[model samples]
Target: MASEEIQIKTDYITLGQFLKLTNVVESGGMVKLFLSEYPVFVNDSQDQRRGKKLYPGDSISIPEVGTYTVTRENA
Candidate 1:
């Protein structure tokens, strides 16, 4: 089945920080474990780096959590 995409504002967010903001995992260690064990697709490609810098226009897709397109919005 296809997953729905969720848009998230990332005006000044790094990949690690974004994961924390979205509550994907409890901490950086958890995110690292999840990224290694689980499939995290970025723009349809697998992304295993937990500290991969994410900026506006980047998109990430998680199996159970659906997709997230990065957008820059005013804080």
Candidate 2:
């Protein structure tokens, strides 16, 4: 599957923020509901925590949504 790269300037980003950055959900408040309804995978393992930490090089996949790869932005 095609993977979209998400660039982050910080050391880490939460799963909720990742979802927002990718436009997978409309708002931060919707992250919880989205997680409850959909299966999200982090490094190929199921992850459902909104506060889960995601660092550069982490991979996330959500069935029917899309796959994503975290990357650090050049400073």
Candidate 3:
């Protein structure tokens, strides 16, 4: 799938937080369940850590959800 760009106000964002920021998962509880249910790819590799750090240029793929690329917005 084509990747979507997600701009962040900070230098980095956690995987779970990024999911929430992108409106992928509604809540932390949902993120936990979602992670267990589907595979999340970080820079093209399977990553299960909710605390995984995502910096600019990082890519995340949530299977059928869609892919997203991280970018630091003007801040």
Candidate 4:
């Protein structure tokens, strides 16, 4: 699977926001429905919470989608 990097200026971001940022879903409202249909993995562990806090080093994997790595860049 291809790996993608998502840069964030803040300390953390929510899974729902991340999904939208990555274009995995069209909007935040679709996050919940999307999660229920697909398995989302945080560092290889399944996570279904749209509010889950994702740190800079956190890695997200969606089998139907692709792998994403959270990265923090100084602004």
Candidate 5:
């Protein structure tokens, strides 16, 4: 079966910023809380850090929400 892909463009974003950009969390504190309770998958692996830095070409998956492909936009 074919997989669905969602692309996001940004320069350099931390895990917290990514969550905000994706409308996953409203604030940093909320991001932290969600990270601690929910399983965030990075490149198909479980990532449990809210401070993890994310760059271009990084893929993140959240259960039920699907996957997102990160792409850096030129400055």
Candidate 6:
């Protein structure tokens, strides 16, 4: 599937926050279950940490869900 672009004004964002930002999960409550049930890829590597720091140009991919690409924007 085609990846969705998510622009961030900050330098970095956490995986869990990003999930919620992208509406991947309904709420923060789903983050634990989502992480345990699905595989999360950060820049193509499987990562389990919700606190994973995503920098500019980083991409996150989840199977069965859309990929989110992080882009930096000047504030």
Q: Which candidate has the highest TM-score of all? A: 2
Q: Give the alpha carbon lDDT tens digit for every residue of 1-75 in model 2.
A: 899999999999999999998999999999999999999999999999999999999999999989999999999
Off by over 4 Å in 2: none
Each prediction's total of clashing residue pairs, residues at least 3 apart in sequence or on different chains, is 0, 0, 0, 0, 0, 0
* Model 6, span 5-59: residue lDDT tens: 8988888988988999999998988988999999999999999788899998898
User: What would the per-residue lDDT of candidate 3 be over residues 1-75, giving only the tens digit for each residue?
Assistant: 788999999889999999899898899878888888899999999998899999999999888899999998985
Residue 66's lDDT within candidate 6 is 78
- Candidate 4, residues 11-47: lDDT per residue as tens digits? 9999999999999999888999999999999999999
Runs in model 6 deviating more than 4 A are: none
lDDT of 6 at 46: 97
Sort the candidates on TM-score, descending order. 2, 4, 3, 6, 5, 1
**What residue runs in model 1 are displaced by over 4 Å at the alpha carbon?**
1-12
Error of 1 at 32 (Å): 1.3
Cα lDDT, all candidates: 0.71, 0.96, 0.91, 0.95, 0.76, 0.89
lDDT of 4: 0.95
Candidate 5 Cα misplacement greater than 4 A, ranges: 1-11
RMSD per model, one decimal? 2.9, 0.6, 0.9, 0.8, 2.8, 1.0
In TM-score terms, candidate 1 sits at 0.74
User: Candidate 1 lDDT (Cα, whole model)?
Assistant: 0.71
CA lDDT, candidate 3, residue 25? 87
TM-score of each: 0.74, 0.97, 0.93, 0.95, 0.79, 0.91
As a whole number from 0 to 100, the lDDT of residue 7 in candidate 2 is 96
